[model samples]
Every structure is written in C-alpha cells, then in structure tokens.
Target: METQDGAELCFPQLFNTSCKKPSSSTTQAIILYTVMSCVSLLIVALNLLVIISVSHFRRLHTPTNILLLSLAVSDCLVGILIWPGEVFMTTNCWFLGNLTCVIFMFVSIIIISSSVGNMVLISIDRYVAICDPLHYPTRITVSRVKLCVCMCWLCSIPYNSLILKENLTHPGRYNSCHGECVIVINPISGVVDLVLTFIFPITVIIVLYMRVFVVAVSQARAMRSHITGVTLQLSATQTTKKSELKAARTLGVLVVVFLISFCPYYIFSVAGDNSYTSSAGFFVFHMLFLNSCVNPVIYALFYPWFRKAVKLIVTAQILQRGSFEANIL
Candidate 1:
C-alpha cells in the first residue's frame, strides 16, 4: 500500500490497534465511519460532475481544465475504492477476505500516487504558462499534455504493482486477516517513497511557483517603467496593471489551497518517525483525506464561471422539486 510518511511511521502503532480484539463500542465507530463514507461519496459525486461538465462543455476544455479533469477522475477513484473500504474496516473489521483486500490496497496506492503526480504536473504546467508565455504555447501542446498524463501513470505503476506482488506472495511475513494491507516499511524504501512522492515534487512546486511570482513581479515593474517612458499612459497602464494583479491573486489562491490541503500531512510525517502513533497523527491524516473534497468547493466559490454553473444547477434542481411537489399536491 502507498502509505505516506506519517502512515509509514505510525503503522506499528496502528497495526497494534488492528490486532486487538473487536470492540463492543462498534456502533459508535460504525456511525462515524458511515458519516465519513457518505461525505466522501458526496465529494466524489461533485468532482465527477465537475469533470463531466468541463468535458462536455467546449468552453472548459483547455489544457489546465484537462489536467483538473484528470485529477478529479483520480480522486474520484480514491474516494470510491479506498474510503468506503476504510470506513468498513474501521468499524466492522476486515470482512472482505485477502484477495479483495489486496486489490483494494493496490488500487488505493495507485490512485494516491497518481493524484500527487498529477498535482506536480499541474504546478509545472502553470509555472510554464505563467512564467514562460513566449514558449508555453509551442511547448505545452495537447499531445504533450497527454504524454505527461501518461508518464504520471507509468511512474506510479511499478510502486503499486510491486507492493501488490509482495503482499500476495509474502503471506508469512504479512497478515491480511486484520483488514489492513500496507507496505512494511524498510528504511530505504520508506525514505525513497517519502522523497519521491512528497519531498521532491513539493520542492519542485515551491521553486517553480516562487520563480513564477518573481517573474510576474519583474514584468509588472518593467511594464510600469514602459508606461512612464511612454508619457504616462494611464489607461493602458491601469488595464495592464489590473490584469497582472488578478493573475497574482489567482496564483496566491492556488498556493494557499495547495498548502492547506497538503501541508499538515507532510509536516506530521516529516517531524519525527514516532509521531504517527499519537492521536494527533490520526487526526491529521483524516484532515488530509478530507482535503480531497475541498477543490470543487474552492472552484465554485472562487471562480466566477464555476460559481455561475453551480448556481444554475442548483436553481434548476429547486424549480424541478417545486414542480414535482405541486403536481403531487
């Protein structure tokens, strides 16, 4: 399984909990799990709708939108395959047997790895488009975007595939009866995954975005200088200034969303290997999982087009409901 650094560090403690006898307070656990499962389902549905809406509407089919659609699809799979099973196991124990367990674990790993990889790709795409406008069009063509998506999947395949094989074949060392299938953390492998999945990609995103901000600032300054040189063209300068300001605001929002969604999990994981056993660790992990649901809501609230679409859909639904009520009466 693709355990994040926090999970890997904390697995020993979690494994201990899993091995304990079944609890009688399972009803409470069940209720909590069910609620979370429903929430996850709702998020998956919303993201799926967003992806479909973007795909079907010709206006939303740009390269950035395509990348977002791919992310939604990946996250949808994660929510569907991983979250329900997680909810089930948390309350009821592992009832799915070993084969299904292996499959579910494999799927979870693949989806998470793919999702993170897609995020990195998105950051790179944005960086190029924003910072290197002259070359972006030639460099980031449709075919090239397709290739990048393909490459992300290709990179994820080996980690998920090998872990699945290991789980199936190494039954002596591994136990699936407890309802958890995770990679046994070898120090080297654990470090490698942490660096590749979290450290390296995050570093790249930070660096690229920082460079983009610097470039944007420099361009704004240069534009101001040009405006002053051209006898203080206030109208053109103001328009250009406004556009630059909006771009900066958009990038700022993106960075904030990314940090809010991902930073806690990474921080908890990296602080210390022993930190995962604490109650705080579990809370942080759950918080990270919940972040998958945030992107659609963020889009709806922040982007005018998405906000309009959401309003239209909601109004139509309400009108349809009212008509049904009247007919029934």
Candidate 2:
C-alpha cells in the first residue's frame, strides 16, 4: 500500500498532501515530453525565422506584412515562453510556486489574446485591400498598421488581466493538493471569454472573409470575361484586381487555419468539459498552441516572398549591407 501510494504521488515526501502523478505510463510520459520538447524547439525556431524575415527586409514592409509581423511576434512568444512551460507542467509537479504559476498564466493569456487581435487586424486589412481598393493605399499605411499592432498588444494586457483576475488575487486557489497547479474559470467569466474571444472574433473573421471571397470571385470573373475594353488602362486595372484577389486568398487560408486551431478549445469549454486535467482539454490547449507553429508554414506555402526570405535568411545573405533593401516581393 505504501509502495503503491509512493509510486502514485507526485512528491513522495509530501505523502498525504501530495498530488497524484499522471496516470500515463512511463513510456507514454517520456514520449509525450520528447514530442512536446521537439515541438517547442521547432515553434521557436520557425517563428524566429519569420520575425527576422519580416523585420530585416524593407520591401516586405507592406500593411499586410505588418499584421503578419505582429502575429509572428505573439506566436514567437508562445514558442519561447508558453510551450516550454506547458511541457514542464505536464511532466512534473508544480514546483515553481503559485505566484510563478499565476504570472505564467497571465503572460500566456496576453500573448494568445494578442494573437487573436492580430488575426482580426489582418482580416480588416485584407477587407480594405480587397473590398475598397481605391482607398487602401491611403487607409492602410505603415504607420497606421504599426499603431494598430501596438494597440492590439497593449489592449490584451488589460483584457486578459480581467479574465484571470481570480487567479491573480488568489493564486493556486483551485489546487487540490501540494505539487499541483490548476485554474478554474467560473461560469460567468468563462461565458464572457467565450463570447468575446472566440465567438465574436470568429464571427467577424468569417463575415469579412465571406465578403472578401464574393468580391474576389466577381473580380476574377470580370478579368476572365474581359467585360471592360482591353486598353492599357483596363490592363492595369486587371493587374491590380488580380493582386488583391491573390492576397485575399492567401490571407483567407491563414484565417481558416487559425480558426481550425482555436475552435476546439472553446468548443470543449462550451461543453463544460474543459477541465485542465482531462485529456481532451490538454489536446485542445496544445492545438491552440500549434497555430503558432503552423502560421509560418502557411506563409511559406502561399507567399513566395516568405519562401524567398527564408532562403536569404538560411543562406546568411541577409547579413550583407543593404540586404534590407532586397526586392523580396
């Protein structure tokens, strides 16, 4: 009995007060940790490349790319801070103390919320470019985009601070025993989070993308049918329309992938089964984290500029003087 209890407890020395170890077998735990560690490293490395690519190349500094940069920054934080912390929590006891746990949760929420905000900004940017191309040049300037990115991040702090207020005031209040860390979102806060973060943002993204799609399709049809006379003026208009449509398609993919990654967590939350200890919750939370890893991958697939930037970065050609002015687009 003593041996069995010792084996199950996270901290054997704590005896009666200790939390139980996860029921996973030794091999399973080892495999999970190894996979998570590799993913952590990959997420950090990939997003770091994105950060460098966008930041270094001057020609890539368009309004849409600015939104991507903000997203990369938030995703990089997830890789650098959130993934490793998750790995540690999954495999070990809560040795970091309640204060540290609370701080970790706070930072994690802020980064995630900032990511969602960046996605919304991206959608809005694409909407203007596709739906209102006449004013896109003036409306979506670099300085304005930079300001929006700053606001997205700054607003996330206060927004998430409110969501995690219970944890802030009383860290570890939900812990069942020593060597454990957990957060329990009461129904009111959970509902508010669901509506604000998941439901509202997703609704806006879908609606905007739907409009973008309609406009893009109509523009494509116009170009194909040669509805307008084929003067040099018409040719120029066609080229511009094609560019806008392509951007919309690429950004549409980005938004769709983000929704795919984010929806599971909220869905489970709404089902009232988002217990942190449960397997489904664990999987969904990591699914959300995986979005950070996949964003640059999507960029590489759809954006030739990202591919070119990666090549320059990997070859160390970006180190040369005036490389920032390279024609990445």
Candidate 3:
C-alpha cells in the first residue's frame, strides 16, 4: 500500500511478508532510526543526570530549577517509552500485537502533548515572573507549579485516549499487518486533533512569549533609566539588570530552539493533507524525533548554572573512574 507521502509499501501484509528482501528505503529507515535512537538515548541519560544531580544538590533546587527538572524528566520518559517503538516502526517493522500498538500510540500521544503543554507552562511562568515581579512570589508557589504539571497531563489524556480508541477501532483498509493500529483518516477527526494539539498550544506559547519579550524589554529600559538617574552607578543596579537581561536572553534561546525543532513537523502534519506516503511520514517522524534530543543542548547554552553542573558532574565521574582503576591496580 502507498502512504500519503508517496512512498510505496505493501500493507495488510506483515513486515517480513511485505517484501522478499530489504529495500533501499528500508535501509535508509534503519540508518535514520539507529542514529536517532543513539542521540535520544544520550539526551535521556544527560537529562536524567541533570534531574538527579539537581535533586541531590541543595543549591540547585530553586523554582526555576524545579521546572527544568520536570522538563528533563518528561524528556527522559519520552526517550525511554516513546523512542524505542518509533525506532522499531522505522527500522525493523511494526511487529507488536494490536494491544501493544494501541498502548504505544496512546503513550506517545500523551508524552507529546505533555511536552508541548509543559513548554507553555514554562513560558507562562517566565512571563509572570518577569512581567509581574511584584506579585510573582505569591502567584507562583510550589503548589501552583505542581498543579500546572498535573493539569497538563490531565488535559492530555482525553485527546490521546480518543485518538487511541479511533486507531484501534478503525483499521485503515490498506493497513499492512492489520494487527498494528494507526489513526484512521477521517477529515473531521484529523482537523480536531491538529487544532487541539498544534494550533491552540502553539498560539498560546507564541502569545505568552511575546508578552514576555515586551516585559523584558521594558524592564531593561527602566533599569537603564534608573541607573542613569543614580549618576551612572554601575555596581548593584547594573549587576541586577545584567542578570535579568541574561535570563531573558536564555529564555529567548529556548523558545527559538523549541520552534526550530518542532515547527517543521507540525507544519507538515497540518498541511500534508493526510497522505501517509512512507517517505513524507518517515521524514516528518525523524524531525519530530530530533526534537526530543535537542533540549539538553539548549539548556546547556541558555542556563549557565546547568552548564557548569554538567561539567562538574562529568569531571567528577572521570576522576572517580580513575581512582577506582588505581585501587584495582
């Protein structure tokens, strides 16, 4: 059967039976899957370390760090639970039975929805802290952050659960290995899922970040004015202003990286007209997978403390290994 993107494949037939031998497209898919798997695993490992280190070290447990830890945990779960099935679907084939297919697809949808929702929460958190600093302390308590995280997952459940049910009930006519489930292409359902998953969340993120940018700029200007009024005193006020500017810059970097990694996939999914051609689907899948692997690097670049922490952790690990070797000798 042909997918929406125009790649050719046999469907309703199991992977082993679809073709007598592996094809070039299959080889490419394998390579892509392998590379993505390795990258995602590396990202997961690093993020896990970040989470653990932050939790263990007293100095690293600020509210901002707590949000970062949550993001890292989500990414790690995505890497562990979602990426493996993705790799299998990309490389070997969809060999899992119907139950697994539903579970995998359901979990993946939840993870993705939660990831985007968490980003929205992060943006809102920053926006409130920067724009309404006077009330931020009272507004952004630990309980509130926890509630936000819980709400994200709660919001995700219905969307993913519906999609999962649809995939299981409506096996596409051309589906190879009818055992594996996929979202059936009903235009209405597709449009709803697209709007809920991509359109609304993306709009929220953009609006919140825009507000954040405006607030940041205003604060910077006010700080400059206050500094001038103080006869160009460059110590306390200047340092505080500089730190705020740095934080704003870091948030900007994060927003950019997020958009860069995920935009293509969303755009393609929204515009592709539901054609499941193997090539286009595979290409978009790969891009989405890349998104899961990008957060660590972005964090390192934007957060100096996180960067230093990672460095210290790595150095300590190396030293410990050396000492152990010496003892063995």
Candidate 4:
C-alpha cells in the first residue's frame, strides 16, 4: 500500500514536504506535451531562420531589419529558454531546484522586456521613416540603431535584476512544498511590473504607430494624386516613397498582432496574479508566447526580401563568398 502511494508523490523520499504528481491522465499529458513541444520547436526554428537571414545578408542590414534582428534574438531565447521550462513545469515537477528557477525568471523577464523595447524602437523607426522622410537617413542610421539596441539590452539586465532581486536573494521562500518552484511579487511590486513591462512600452508603441498610420495614409494619397515627374531621379524618389508606405503597413499589422497576443496576459496581471496557473491563464500565457513565433511569419507574408533570404539560406547559397552582396532588396 505504501509503495503504491509513494508512486504518486513527486519526491517519494520526503513524503510530508513533497508535492504529488499532477493528476492529469497519461494520454492527456502526452497530448499536451506533444502540442506544446511542437509549438516550442516551431518557435525555435522560425526565429532561428529570421536571425540567420538578417545576420547573413549584408543587404538586409538596414536600420529596420536591425531592429527586427534584435527582436528575433529575443524571441529565439523565448523559444529556446523560456517556453521549454514553462512546458516542463506545467506537467512535471520542478527538478532543477531554486537557483535555476530564479535564473529562469530573471532571463525570461529580460527576454520579454527587451522584445517590447525592440517593438518600441521599430515603432519609432517607422514613424521617422513615414512622417519625416527627409531626415530619416541621418536620424535613423544603422550605427544609431545598433547603439539603441545595445542600451535597451544593457538596461534590461539591471532592470530585471532589480525586479527579481528578492527571488534571487531569498530564493524559494514562496514554495509550499519541495518539488515546486514559485516566485511571488507582492501587490506593490506586481503593480510596478505591470506598469513598467506593459503600460509604458505599449503606450509608446500605440502612440507612435497611430501617428505613423495617419502620416502614411496622407503620404499615400499625395503620392497617388501627384505623379508628374518621370525623370530617373524622380522615379527613384517615388519608388522609395512607395517602399516606405508598404513597410509602414506591414509593420502596423505586426504591431496589432503583438498587442492582441500580449493584452490578455497583462490584463490577467491587472486582475491579480491569482489566476496565473488557471486554464484562462495558461491559454493567455501560451498566446503571449505564440507572438514570438508569429513575428517571423508576419515578415514572410509581407516582406519579399525575407522570402528571398530564406530561399538563399535553405539552399545553402549563403555559404558562397559573394552571397552577402546579393540584391536581396
């Protein structure tokens, strides 16, 4: 009888202090694992492709693609580091101990917040490109963009370190039993996190994109109505305007999808973190993670350069010496 009972415990040796294995059925657990594993793998593969495509192609090293590449790196970590840990924790006991848990939380927070930072940079890039095209060349140079991305990441390290300091110092104080890992931010800290991670970044993104949308529409109408110059210089300028307009529309779609995916997760935080492991919570969390995977798909759908880059990457043509200078544009 004791042997049979022991089989159900997460840490059978420490019966009183240990959590029991979750009561989900074997088949159900298999299905959930299978599905989540696939999602995690797909996220890794897609984001890896984005990272490789942008990094390998010299022609794709524009300010805008630089931001996307930064975002892809953040998303790739989400796929590689965050989601797998989440999946393991959902159906299995925490076997890695408290230090690993603290590190996991710290890294997850950095990856997510930095992804939001990238989006804000992207919004600013689009805004400048559309509303102030004349100065964009100087204002949004590749060097400046690289500097911003670096600062965003460096700031994230300290910011998340501060937010997670309690967990790091105190370790697993919130866990009710062995075989479990939990991090608790009190109400005040939770409010601060919600504001910092969601409210401020999202506000900037929405406000900038709203301005971009207005400016892009007006510019598109102006381009349509005033098409007189057929000179080579004029033609190049017109083509540049058309390209900028299309890019704005594409990025606008990406931002909308990002908001939709992440809103539920933040809204849940606002409501209280009580439901974080509930069914609704699980769904929203997965949805938020899914945004990482969806970003590259958005690129594939809207950016022909991305499609061509992928072709070159997959066919191994990028291994050639002159591949970097290929006319991806």
Tell me how far the alpha carbon of residue 295 in candidate 1 is from the true structure, in angstroms, after superposition. 0.8
Per-candidate alpha-carbon RMSD to the true structure: 8.6, 1.9, 6.4, 2.1
Q: What's model 4's overall lDDT?
A: 0.85
Candidate 1: minimum summed lDDT over ten consecutive residues — where?
320-329
- Report the candidate with higher TM-score, 1 versus 4: 4
The order of the candidates by lDDT, greatest first, is: 2, 4, 3, 1
Give candidate 3 regions above 4 Å deviation. Answer: 1-34, 169-174, 178-181, 228-241, 272-277, 315-329
RMSD of 4: 2.1
Residue-by-residue lDDT tens digits, candidate 1, 23-123? 44667776787788788888787787667556555565567767777778876765777667655544444545556766665666677678778778777
lDDT of 4 by residue, 1-329 (tens): 12355447778788778877777888999898898889888999999999998888888989999999998998888888888887777678888998998788778778878888888999999999998999999999999999999999999998877777788898787888887767776777788878888999999999999898888788777777767756788778889999998999999998899889888888987888732345676677688899999999999999999999989989999999999889988
lDDT of 3: 0.66
Q: Write the per-residue lDDT of candidate 2 for residues 1-329, one digit (tens) a residue.
A: 13464457767787878887666777988898888888988988898888899899999888898899889988888888988887677667778898898898789878878888888999999899989999999999999999999998898888878888888899988888887767778888889988998899989999999999888888888789996569999898888888778888888999999999888878988999634656676678799999999999988888899899999999999999999999988
Give the range where candidate 4 is weakest over 10 consecutive residues by summed lDDT.
Answer: 1-10
Model 3 / residue 144 / CA error / Å: 0.9
- Cα error, residue 86 of model 3, in Å, equals 1.5
Model 1: what TM-score? 0.75
lDDT tens readout by residue for model 3, 1-329: 64445444544354444422224576787777778778777868877866866765556655566776777777788778767766565445455655676667667768777878777777777877777765777998777887788888887888666755556564444355433344444667677878887788889888988888887788778776776546445556467556656766776676677777677766776775453335666576667656656777776766766666666567775245333222110
**Candidate 4 regions with alpha-carbon error over 4 angstroms:** 1-7, 228-232, 274-276
Better of 1 and 3 by lDDT: 3
Q: What Cα-based lDDT does every candidate model obtain?
A: 0.63, 0.86, 0.66, 0.85
